[model samples]
Target: MDQRQDILAQWAADQIEQLYQHSIPAQMVTVSGDASFRRYFRIIYSENGVHKHWIAVDAPPEHENSRQFVDIANVWSNAGVKVPSVLAFDEAQGFMLLEDFGDVLLHPELTADAADGLYKSSIDSLIELQQIARTDNIPAYDRKLLDCEMALFSDWLCEKHLGLMLSCDEKLMLNQVFETLANSALAQPQVMVHRDYHSRNLMVCKANPPLHDKDFIGIIDFQDAVYGPLTYDLVSLLKDCYIQWPREQVLAWLAYFKAKSAQITDINEDQLVRDFDLMGMQRHLKAAGIFARLSIRDGKHGYLNDVPRTCEYIMQTARIYPEFAAFTEWLESVFLPALNKEKMA
Candidate 1:
């Protein structure tokens, strides 16, 4: 183990022993990490003839928001949301001891036979999540933040990664469409938006023991939660970047979510569909840009593989509205050719 790993293991051991007086310290096994700078490890220990594990997070204070994670986890956990329990944390050192949700991510479990049931079950949890009242700690997904996120596509994907210099008309079209999308988001009924709520961030807890809820799903990587448009989380799930579903199937699930969501919020069928479509375009633009940035700046090239799929989402959604016709044309003629060239070379 390196210096930081050694420190994390010792601190995690001490924290676990404090919680269970007779617990014996064991080796800290490495666990997978997410897109951000956070690294995770699991320390397996024994107490009362039973072996258990606790996940230790190494989120550098400079890069990640450890404080917001603890605050949001506590708030959601109290509200009966299936978030991992926070046992102990050292905010100064950026280490946290969290309950183990185990290794089953909702991403790989998705299949033709299993997709419907898995999605419906997750949608059930989402309805419960949006019902939780927003607090001061949660920020608003305002126009500024929305615009800034969309800018990633132009800055990273177009200019930096693809080496394309946008024409004057191209920039104007993007700016106009961005304004329209952000306005649509603001006009919707605001709710708690789990910014990165998707297959990778969701855990299928079926094989693991049910501790938090009998429902058997766990949510993680929620430090970026915000009070935003109601359709944000829904669109993120159905139009996931990691996986794609048929358009018909996606809208079917969208209707299911809207039917349930409208019971709590004042959303009708037409408005929900428009909101879901527009919200997806905005998210895909941001996501495509982020994926390009991840490859160019962060040296995480695997994410770029999802950029084409993400852009296809933007194109399909753009076709629904007449105002986006020119933007859609630019994406096809300009963006796609550049991407294909990059892939070839």
Candidate 2:
């Protein structure tokens, strides 16, 4: 077992003993994922003639954000989103005992046949998330936060990963693009945006059936929820980093989401399309930069393979906007070719 597995095993044992206060037989099984800072384990315990199992998330206070996870999980759960129920949490140790939602992620369900239905349902869940995000009670997804994330693209990916220094004009263009994207995003009606609403973060519960009031979509890794643009979560789902859907399917889902939004929020369809595309571009760029940084700085090379697709998303989106004509030209002539060469070599 690795260090993470060992820690999780110990945490599970401790939690069963300390928190549950049951001197019952307990077994711990580590779950699989590419998690960096946190570890997850399923704990099975038998007590008082009943058998129960729970997922124990061991975040190791120094390495992860357990508090945010607890807070945001509560918020989403209260909003009728299907997330794991929190059974118990220890903030100091960053250990959370949560309801086990089973381990079937949406990634394996993305075949050509099931793609349409899965995406349609996924969009419905996303719309529900947007409706909840629009509430003023949630925290703001302000300009500073958006700009800070955008800056990571410049500082880490452009300068550090690609070793390209932005000229004055290039910097101005970058700023203008991000400003337009951010303003458009911020101006949109706010909602509870799951900053990382992707396939991996979603779980399909087979063991425990969903409640009537709750959604079938079991959301996880949503600690970074923000109140921002309605299109942000939509883009995250449609332009997913792990799995790629065909353009036609992506458009169909987009149209479905637009109609849903119009019905709920009375937003214009064309503007929603523009916002989705622009937000996708911004997100793709950030994802590419983060992927590169993860490889170079964090010593995680698995993400490097996904950089090309992320860059492709940026290139594809840039082609649709006339305002980005110059940037698009530069991307095609300079960035795309260079990235391709790097990939091939």
Candidate 3:
């Protein structure tokens, strides 16, 4: 084990001892990690003759904000959302002891037959999350952030990863498209947005007949929650980067989300569709760029496999809006062919 993992393991043991009066923990086993710098592990030990399991987090103080994660978990948990409870944490060392939600992520369980039920539960959880009153800690998904995130596409995916230098005209057109997307986001009603509210971050507990069970949700990787456009999370769920759903099915779910979120956000289907479309464009660009950054800068190349799917979302949305016509033409005629060549070579 590395020095940091050893430190985290010792820290977790001491914390467990304090929590249950000398309850020693077993060796921590590595759990799956995400695109970020954080690592997770599962620890099991006996307490009062019953086995107890907890997930230990190594967030690395320089790379992650453990304090914000604990704070948001508390905030959302109190709001009746089912988040992994933060049992304890050390902000300085960036270590945390979290409730174990087992190994069931919502992604693999999302079958064609079970999609509707599982999504219904997830959508309910999302609406409840959005209803949480904004706190000072919650950041606004503002114009600056929106534009900065979208620029990742041109900067990381296009220039850094794809080696595509944009012409002056191409650069200007991309900027305009970015501005249009950001404005569309800013125009929508702001709500509590779990920035990465896709299937992978969600855990499926007791996935059975009771789809509406509030306790069935096991939400993780929610440290980046923001006050943003209502449609952002919805689009992330339906047009997931790692998975694809039929357009007709996606629209159907969008309608359900619109109906479910009506009390919190008021908008007609046409406007919601437009906002959802444009908001998706913004997110997919950000996601594609993030995936590229993950591959090139972070040495995590598996995420590159998902870039095409993310770009497909962008291409599909670009086709829907006339304002994105130039962007669409550029993508079809220039960007996609470059991506295909990059992959082939």
lDDT of 2 by residue, 43-77 (tens): 88775696767887778788787887887777777
Count backbone clashes in candidate 3: 0
Better of 1 and 2 by TM-score: 1
In order, how many clashes per candidate? 0, 4, 0
TM values, all candidates: 0.96, 0.89, 0.95
**Residue-wise lDDT of candidate 3 within 235-281, one digit each (tens)?**
88888998999998999988888787754455778998898889999
Q: What TM-score should be assigned to candidate 1?
A: 0.96
Q: Predictions ranked by TM-score, top down?
A: 1, 3, 2
Query: Top TM-score: which candidate number?
Result: 1
Error of 2 at 292 (Å): 1.4
How far does residue 217 in candidate 3 sit from its true spot (Å)?
1.6
Q: How much is 40 displaced in model 1, in angstroms?
A: 0.8
- Against the reference, the lDDT scores of all candidates come to 0.89, 0.77, 0.89
For model 1, the local distance difference test gives 0.89
Name the regions of candidate 1 deviating beyond 4 angstroms.
46-49, 207-210, 213-215, 262-265
Candidate 3 stretches with Cα past 4 Å from truth are 46-49, 207-215
RMSD of 1: 1.6
TM-score of predicted structure 3: 0.95
Candidate 2 deviant stretches above 4 angstroms:
1-11, 17-27, 33-36, 45-52, 133-138, 207-215, 262-265
Superposed by TM-score, candidate 3 places the C-alpha of residue 249 at a distance from the truth, in angstroms, of 0.5
